[model samples]
Target: MDKRRTLTESALLLLVSLFVMISQGFAAQQVIYLLTAVFLMGIGFLLPKSVNWILILSTMPLCYWWPDIAYYLPPLLRILSMPTKRFEAATFFVYSATLLLLPLSAYQGIIVMLLAISLYLRQNDRAMTTLGQDFLASTDDHWEKQQQLALQNKQLLDSHETQLALQIAEERNRIARDIHDNVGHLLSRALLQIGALETINQEPVLEEPLAQLKQTVDTGMDHIRLSVHDLHADSLSFAEAFQNLLMIEHLCPVEIQGSLFTDLTDKQHNCLSMVIKEALTNTLKHSQATLLTFHFKTLPAFYRLQIRNNGIITNEQYPPKTGIGLQTIQQRIRLINGQVHIAQTDTHFQLTITIPKEPTK
Candidate 1:
């Protein structure tokens, strides 16, 4: 495109020079006009966009020395200016050159107008091309940012799902341990006692019923063992489980202190797990908290768990109304013979639970 534009400008310069030579019919005057016009045109073409103003300045000499034919120079100057500046330059040249050339010939006035219009339109086209490139660049940047945000959201969701699954698996294992350790042990002991009773008995009538009872006890113990094995398929430490729960990004910062794990009855573990899950859910759904803390420890014959959060309390009054979730939590604690206390203030909510290391029969 640049090469074509150069060729076109050179051709126009040649045509204008030939016309001036024919019209003036003076060799010296023709040589002066031709050289001045060619020099200005060459400077305009050579200067980069950075030095376009120099090209504009070059036009003054043409206007002064060759006032009669100065209208030919503005079109040549248009080549050096950038797209955004082209329109203004074209307008200036048209008005300035017309003042000098308009009275000389009606033909000259028409030619100058035609050239100005062509320059203005070409500059406008260049401006549009530049604007289109900028628009495309902005759109591409926005698309890349959107893609990055979508990928982050997907990763967050995957992490949340993995944490919830781990919680479920841990709960299952605890259940299996409870059944095997409590029920299986009791049944096996009963079967042994029945066998000892059989050896002491001397009656044939008592032997049949004793054998039947032993078979039932043996079967129950076997089933309990199998179920316990199935439940123990996956086990996660308490510290790791807590870490996963805290992986939820938008939630407040969580701090877990004291012992993360210890030996506790299945019932106590289940109660504590339930409370933690419910507390986290409530915090996410209703509480606008900035910090949460969990403190777990062993106190003599009791296992103690304390949870506190710096979230807005729904009610200002003491002894707040109990929802079904809280009622459920209380009921679970009662079943394990544990003590639960929930307290709330304007800026904080707290839950404290204490269960016996060995749950009641």
Candidate 2:
């Protein structure tokens, strides 16, 4: 039961018991019964539910000894204040027995019964209110869980779609490579043979035919080259490719931040991928780093990549005297008209790269 409701019920019971004692005319015995009622009510409120049964049973002996029907009010009030239904049926039987066995006037018996009935109804109302609140709380929890599940399912579906797209791109690239290697080489060989025939031919009539055959082979080679280029370009999805790279096993934990929304040419994608790969490799091989991070950002005119590690680079490794890795990184950036900056301090090493949005001719 709620504390406020319990206090209210106890107060009402106390007031009613006092009124009944005064109406029946004050006596030493009446005063004692009132005092005892207050004491038992206090105990019922302060103690746990386990002690309630003992208090109720104690009331049985008091009722027989005192035989005043009004004395039963305190224990009945205690029963009404109880939150559990465990002792309800037994308590009702005990109260009914006491009411029937007591040799009291009909008026006293009726008043006691009416008060008990009213208190019982109030207890039922409080119980219903508590049950409704519990149901609402449970419903709220169920709804929140469903929302979380839906979000997780959406994320799962998006991941599957991205993987499927990557697989298709890979297959297309494979087909393009096969065509370029086999058919393109054969066409080139035929064109070369036709050129040699034209050079060695003494018959003037065969020269035009040889030139036309060489032209056809050259056209087929051009078509193969164009197709291969398209396949490679289509295969380079910067976001997906970068995510795949991040998934690779590394010595240190890597934190990735930022978003990829800018479109990149195939060359730009490959350049950035290689640069990132080399940087990661250097960090693993040279630095005693425990954590690595990659931050990517797209600016109005350029795409920026920042690779950082909480590791120190000694004087021997600072300028990179003999290593080809840093040199290759610099060379690749220059090819795409991008800038590279390397910074090292006592606590951290950072590599920043920025490539122009528009490719330079």
RMSD value for candidate 2: 14.9
Q: Per-residue CA lDDT of candidate 2, range 117-225, in tens?
A: 6457555756876898999899999999998898567655654543454456557667887888898888888888888898899999998888888888898889888
202-282, model 1: which lDDT tens digit per residue?
999999999999998988888887777668633444556566767766778888879865565444555566667877877
TM for every model, in the order presented, reads 0.48, 0.49
Q: Count the backbone clashes (under 3 Å) in each candidate.
A: 0, 0
Flag regions of model 2 displaced more than 4 Å: 25-35, 64-86, 100-106, 122-148, 151-159, 174-194, 197-250, 253-361
Best by lDDT: 2
Per-model root-mean-square deviation over C-alphas: 13.2, 14.9
